[model samples]
Target: MMKRVTLGLFGAWLLHDAEEWFTLAPFSARKAASGGGQVGLPWMRREISEAHAHTAVALVGVVIAAASARGYRTEGRSRFYQAALAGFGLHGFSHLGMTVAERGYTPGVVTAPIVVLPFGYYAHRELARTGVARPGLRTALEGIAVAGGALAASHALAGMLHPATSAATP
Candidate 1:
């Protein structure tokens, strides 16, 4: 059960993020074109190109895969795996929260409730049922920090690998 949950994380992440991968660039483009004067939190306002979105998604996929593999290998005992699982759950909620805050659809919002949230909840419950140590505050915090750092790095790396065209609107 734990093994299935661990592997399921990867599949769930891919499904959730694939929504973002396909929709984010176009959504940002539309939002920019509408002159809506930035939406949601300030940090969410940055417009990105399709290339950047693709690269970032691909990069993060690797991290998710590594975390899932670690979880499977350790049978939910690895700290990193626990942190990643917690982070994934948090991230799923964030998508829903962001959509509500924006009062509109956001990339990955569709899958957040369907795939990401459900999988996160089910995985955590199964892990607990199987005698895996329940995640503590430290694990949750670590998950958030690690996920944030990875996302930042992925964005940075994407920028470097796929420089924005000057003609591209901000």
Candidate 2:
């Protein structure tokens, strides 16, 4: 059940990304028509086009899905799983921050509260219950660090692999 919760977090992230692609892409394009991928952050927005964003989201989803499967198979004790789980779960906060920062609707804003935050909190508790991760400050901090690095790397790679382009936009 705990492992399932982790997987659900990943699924929620997938949906959130979709929401961003379909809706946020336009906003980003309008924000940066200068052909830079820096929509809101350095590692985000590989391109102004929604298609590029969609592709990036899909690739990252594959990574999360694979990591979640491996973690569940290993009884939710794998570092990859833990890091990915924690990283993805905590990722919801970024959306929330973005929404608040913009003071308006952002792509992932709609799902952040309803799906992302709840799933992350739920999975964190489930992991504790399953003994996959102990409840401790150090452990939590480590998990958070790994998550940050992983997200940064994923964002960087996604942009590098595809290269931001106006062609990706509608």
Candidate 3:
């Protein structure tokens, strides 16, 4: 049951990320400044190149898939899973903050409420349902670090690559 639930969250995250890569990145690219960059968190910034956005999405997908495939029922595994839930929950809020900060739409905002919320809720609920201990602050911090690093790396890598698409394309 824990395995299934964890896998489900991973699947949803993959889909949510797809929305960002396919829809959000391309859409936001048009609005990004031509000469100057915007300010925000590394991953949640307004000027992320499309290549990096897609790369980041793909990397996260790989991580989630690997985590699901490996196993998530043990004590350490449960801690990571719980932490993932909390981290993802925080990620969702980050998107909301991005939206508010920009005073407009932002990449990942569309799916944040839809995909992130339910998955986080169910992931946490399923973990609790299965008797997994809620992660402590340390575990939560670890989760945040892992997720933040993965996402920030993706953004950095995207900047290194060529643009995935032109701003003219719809």
Candidate 4:
């Protein structure tokens, strides 16, 4: 059950991120084209190129895969795996909130409710059932912070790898 649950995290993340990867580029393009980019918070106003967006998603995938691997090897005993699972579960809420804030469909919003939340809940339940120790609130929060920081770093790396270009000449 632990093995299945651990592996399930990777599979579910793949599905959720696949949705994000495909939609993000197009969505950002549409927003930029419509001048919707200018109407949001400073962070939202920055538009990411398709390459950068996809690369960031891929980078996160690597992190998820590593966590899943560690969980599988440790048979759910690893604190890192426990924290990651808890963090991933809670991360789904961010997607829902993003959709609400945007007042429209957002990437990963669909899968957050269906795939991410359900898998996270099921995985956590199975972990508890198997007598694996919970990561505790502090570890869970740390996991979330790590995940968020990793995402930001991935985006920065992606940007460096594929810097956004402009048609206008200086």
Candidate 5:
């Protein structure tokens, strides 16, 4: 039951990302600009670039996964939950590294990664403890992650193709 709920939440998060691709990409770019410091200053645009509605949805999925883990721990399915947590933790760490490398580690600019990384890590650890993931499940998750990554890349491309302009009347 808890596994099902976690999967459902992740599914919903994927759908939400699809829905917000257009709007969110540009918003993220703009927010990055605002957050990035002036020229020659240590800018932190990468963290800003991750600002998207889908991120909130993903966070919600993390919460659900964690709750599900707690509910299932007695069953000795901790490894499955741990794998899930590891996957997300890796994702977060990668993202954070990208952000810091592209944009200097500004104090306030690093909030998004700082908040989400530990949350995702904890959630995954709990899930591993509680769930029993099948062999096929790992493949499916990899496929889903790939597809989601592609969709996000496309959204970023679209934003670049149709650059937003302040001169254009709202």
Candidate 6:
């Protein structure tokens, strides 16, 4: 049950990412700015690029969750499932936090109530239903989330430190 719920959430996230990448990114910046939002030009592009990266991350998470679900059910291997869930949850939270910090709290306000709330609720309920409240599983989840969070933060910081160089001939 827990695995199924995770899979469902993963699917929903993938769909959301597809919408953001294919629809929102291309025109959102121009629309927001022209509509009187004070967002700067470069920042808009940065937001769009970040959205693309997020889409990629979510796709990876979906694959991991799907594969882990199959393996766990087939072999009674809870570790992989726990690790994948924790990683996906942590990645989602990290990106949400970073977006709030970089963009402003307003976006987080919009997303939290809509996206995070449902995902967190469903995941938590599924975990409880599956009796994954064991200490070892809990510890594994915490560790995986922490490790994934660290990696994500490092990547974001590296990008900040070494931004892309572009041609001047445009």
Q: Considering every candidate listed, which one attains the maximal lDDT?
A: 1
True lDDT of residue 26, candidate 4: 73
Q: Which ten residues in a row have the lowest lDDT in candidate 1?
A: 36-45
For model 3 the local lDDT of residue 124 reads 68
Model 1, span 70-138: residue lDDT tens: 999999877888788888888888888878877888888999899988888898888888888566799
Q: Each candidate: how many clashes? A: 0, 0, 1, 0, 8, 0
C-alpha lDDT (0 to 100) for residue 167 of candidate 4: 14
Q: Report every candidate's CA lDDT.
A: 0.80, 0.66, 0.65, 0.78, 0.41, 0.47
TM-score of each: 0.91, 0.76, 0.78, 0.89, 0.37, 0.49
Give Cα distance to truth, residue 82, candidate 5, Å: 9.8
For model 2, residues 81-127, the per-residue Cα lDDT tens digits are: 77666666677787788767756666777887887778767877888
Reference-based lDDT, residue 78, model 4:
78
Q: Arrange candidates by TM-score, highest first: which order? A: 1, 4, 3, 2, 6, 5
Model 5 lDDT, residue 61, Cα: 52
lDDT of 2 at 141: 68
Give Cα distance to truth, residue 123, candidate 6, Å. Answer: 2.2
lDDT of 5 by residue, 61-143 (tens): 55435534553553424444434433444454544565466464322234335543555544444444555433356734753
lDDT of 4 by residue, 75-110 (tens): 988777777778788889988887787888777889
Lowest-scoring 10 consecutive residues by lDDT in candidate 5? Answer: 40-49
